[model samples]
Target chain A: MTYCVGIEVDEGLVFAADTRTNASLDDVRVYRKLHVFEYPGQAVFAVMSAGNLATTQLALARIQRDVDDAAPRNLRTFRHLFEVAEYIGQVLVSSQVDTAGRPEFEGISTQATLILGGQVAGERPGMYMVYPLGNAIASSPETPYLQVGESKYGKPILDRIIRADTRLEDAARTALVSLDSTIRSNLSVGMPIDLALIRRDDLRITERMRLDADTPLYSDIHANWSRKLTEAVHTLPRFPWELPQD
Target chain B: MTYCVGIEVDEGLVFAADTRTNASLDDVRVYRKLHVFEYPGQAVFAVMSAGNLATTQLALARIQRDVDDAAPRNLRTFRHLFEVAEYIGQVLVSSQVDTAGRPEFEGISTQATLILGGQVAGERPGMYMVYPLGNAIASSPETPYLQVGESKYGKPILDRIIRADTRLEDAARTALVSLDSTIRSNLSVGMPIDLALIRRDDLRITERMRLDADTPLYSDIHANWSRKLTEAVHTLPRFPWELPQD
Candidate 1:
């Protein structure tokens, strides 16, 4: 399982994902689920994946192959961010179909979903969640964020904190906090985490860092968030019964 | 869908449940999920339900009928709280089996899971999560809470705040907060929550309250919690980039 989140705010896009992947208890492995495609000042794309490891790898390989072959249609050829998302969705569907058609993979699911966040020159920065079935939907100004995999444990915080007008740095911090909450509650989503930031209209990845549990910034955030949350609960208005029998 | 939580602490027990049930989007109804069987000074049980509404209704009806008929075994006849849990689990499984075996109920799930929390005189107070399979597990001191239905959204807070030594009033407050989180994140779990608290060795419910969205205590807690959380996030350590880049 993986936990990946992408947030689009007024200042930029924030992408965060946990690196743990496991086929079983004894087969856990760390695999970077955050994939980035950059063409310098032309465009930048951060694609975060969850589900079927092989399917995501194959879809990504096909996208890279298209870029290398200068295919008629590819990530580099897209005019809008949604176009790239659509192409990625198609690749995801094709990969799942090809895998499912194999006799050896009959009962296995080859589905993978992705969050595409970035910008093309002269266009607004955006984020889209591409479905395994070859369709995509953009994040709305109201919601302003997209998530895939082990999402529920981390969702209440996002639903409360994220908005289109939020600052880019605050969104990034919120994403990290959300990931930390999930990693604490669920063992499947572990660190090191991959984080990427793309400032609006920059057409370049701004800050991309890999943070492990021991990394200073990630550790501080985790410890402080936990302490603050505990404090928050303690400070909640006491029950009427707890207030003196007035 | 429902959201119900039972917390057992050294001080006693806390049970909270939302009051919304639906067969379809257009068929929504408010149905209390918390049922109390109190033989005051003898024993008391608070049963919280989630899953097929009809199955739960039938199971509760059977339990009530047995008590009224002075059955050989009933809530009033249990020696230990675990025995009551076992009786409830058997009732739940039999209800599901009977409903599922009916021809008209084919292709539909008749499952219902429950949390039974209470005490019989001379025994320690406890809580059990009874599964649809007629097996049950007690809430331990290490993990002193049991949740059913749409549980994930409300879990992080409980995981952070609950402990074996938490005061019963604080535990009740925590349960309400947990329910509030689930209600905010899930449409299936909603207002007019039913709450019950049993103080250890009392052998009777110490407090029972039905709180709605408009209830003053509930509303105040909601507003204050939201405000405090926002404040908590603002106070989280700033990212290095946002710290003037020194």
Candidate 2:
């Protein structure tokens, strides 16, 4: 289980994801789920994945190989952001097809889902949710975000905070808060968190970093958000009995 | 497709549940999920359910019939709250057994889960989560609450707010906040909400009310929570670049 979110605000795009992976409780491993492909002035793409780690690694490896070989249909060959999303969606499906239903892998779900976002040199930055089945949906003005894996626990924060006009830093903080909510509510999701920011029209990745539980900035965000949320709950209109008498 | 929470605080117990049921998206209906059984001066029990409606109704009917007939092991006969929870768990399993695996209902799950809480004559107030498998677990100091169905989206608030010593009304409000979060995040869970409060040693439910979206207190809670939560998000510490320069 994983939790990853991608937000496409007017300022740019924000991507955040947890870094815990486990085949079982005793077989836990820390693996980076966010992969960035920076083409400097050409294009920059950030892909965050959830589900079978092997499958996601397989898909990522294939994409990297495609770029290395300059395949007829490669990540770098795409002219539009959605085309890149479509190409990655295909890669995800093929990765699962390679192992799912094999006699030895019968019970395991090889399926993987991804949030792919970036901007090409001539196009505007956008984001997409790429399904394990190879279909994709782009984020729009009405819905400025996309998420994959263990999404529900973290969604309310995103629903409340992210907007098309939200500042890039605000959107990034919102994404981190969303990820933190999920990590607290679910055991499968844990830190360190990987975050990437792509500034609109930069045609390059602007910021990419990993945030651990002890990281000063992330720790501040976590502690401050919890305190503020608890204060918010306490500040709610009290029940008739709890109110002070006039 | 339901969300119900049973909380045990020092003041007493709080049980809250949503009122939406559906066979599918297009076949939605509203049905009460919280049921109270009060034995004034003796014991008071509240049972909230999620999962197969028919199975829950069947189990409920059986419990009622057992009490009506004054059977050897009726709800009134239980000496401990756990025993009552156990009795209900068995009833839930029997309810499913009565119709599950039948030819016509091939893919449908007849399983249902329940949260039962109350105080017996001489024992302390307590709560239990009755599983579909007929096993039960009691709420403990570490976790003074139990939830069933679409529980994740609503869980963060419960985790942050509810405690063994929390005031009963505060617990009740927290449950509502939790439910509201779920309703916003999940289509399977919705309003109007049912809330029941049992004051310690009352030997009966102290108060019971159904809250719709338009109900005054509920409406206030909904509006205030949204505004306060957004405020909380904005109050988070700003990033370096977001800070005002000297």
Candidate 3:
């Protein structure tokens, strides 16, 4: 199980993901689910994935190979963010289909969910949720946020907090808080998060870093949020009790 | 879908459940999920259900019929909350198996999960999460909270706040807040909630009532909690950034 979120806000786009993968409880591994394809000031695209690590790795590898070959359909020359998302989704679907030809793929849900968001020089910053089936949907005013993987636990916070006009930084913070809520309650999602921020029309990564247990900002946020939540609960008026006989 | 929570706290026990049921989105109904079996000053027991409504209703019917029979394993005679939970679970399992024999039971999971918690004289305030198999586990100091039916969305708050020594009123408030969070996110879980509070040693209900959409307290708590959450998020320090030139 995994939890990844990508938000396209007025100021920029924010992407965050947890880095824990497990085939079973005893078989756990850490994988950086966020992959960035940066070309200095020209373009900066971040792809975060959840589900079927092998399939995701294969899809990424194939996309990377396509870019390395300087193919016309590669991420480098994609004129729009939608094209980039479509190309990535197409590659992932083809890869899964190719793998399905082998007997080993039987009974496996050879599927991966990817969040593709970034800016190309000519296009505005955009975000999309790319499905494993060679299709994708871009974020819009009505739905400025998108999440994949173990999403339900963390969804309420996003629904309550995220808005179309939300500032880039606040949206990023909301994403982190949402992820924190998920990781605390779910054992499958763990630490060492990868977070990326891209300002609209900047065509560059504003902030991109891997946050682990020792990450100062994350630690501060987690501690303060918990304290505030506790305080908030306590400050709520107690039930109107009709005094019982002592 | 439903969201119900049972907490074993220092003040006593708190049980709350949402009242929404649907065969499908278009076929929806409101049915009370919280059932109480009380013997006035002798004992007060409350059961909350989550899972197939038919199975739950069948189980409840059987339990009530058993008590109505000439030879009854009356909850009034139960020496402990554990026994009360066990009796309920057995009845649930048998009732489910019996109903599965009917045509309407087809394709149903027939799995019902129950949270039974309250005080019965001579025992500590106890709580149990009963599975469909007639086996159950009692809540402990380490796990003072139990939830069933669409539980994940509301769980993070509980995980962070609940402890064995938590005051009953605070726990009740927390449970209500949790339910509010879930209700906002899930279409299948809705209003007219059933909330019950049991006091330690008194073997009687302190407060138990149905909360509808018009209930002032419930409405106020929901509005205030939402506003407080938004305020809390705004209060958090934003990500400090030296703006990068475009």
Write the residue-wise lDDT of candidate 2 on A1-246 in tens digits. 898999999999999999999877788889999999999899999999998888899999999999999999987888998889889988898898666457897787878889899999899999998998899999999899988888888887777667788888878888888888889878888899999999899888888888888887789877777567767766666766567899
Tens-digit lDDT string for candidate 2 (B123-207):
9999999999999999998999999999888887787777777888878888888888889888989899999999999999998
| Candidate 2 TM-score, true structure as reference | 0.91
Candidate 1 collision pairs:
none
Better of 1 and 2 by DockQ: 1
Local accuracy of candidate 1 as per-residue lDDT tens digits, A1-246: 899999989999999999999998789999989999999889999999999998899999999999999999988888988788888888888888555577888878878899999999889999999998989999988788999999998888887777777778778888888898899888899999999999997888988899888888788877777567767777766666778875
Q: After best superposition, candidate 1 residue A40: deviation in angstroms?
A: 3.1
Return the lDDT, model 3, position B159.
78
- Interface RMSD in angstroms for candidate 2: 1.8
lDDT by residue (A1-246, candidate 3, tens digit) is 999999987888999999999998889899989898888778899999988898899999988888899987888887788889888988888766455557777776778889999888877888899998879999997788889888988887777777777777778778888889888878899998888898887777888878776787688777888777777888786566743556
Q: For model 1, what is the error of residue B243's alpha carbon versus the real structure, in angstroms, after optimal superposition?
A: 3.3
Chain A vs native chain A, TM-score per candidate: 0.93, 0.93, 0.90
Q: What is the C-alpha lDDT of each candidate?
A: 0.88, 0.88, 0.83
Clashes of 2: 0
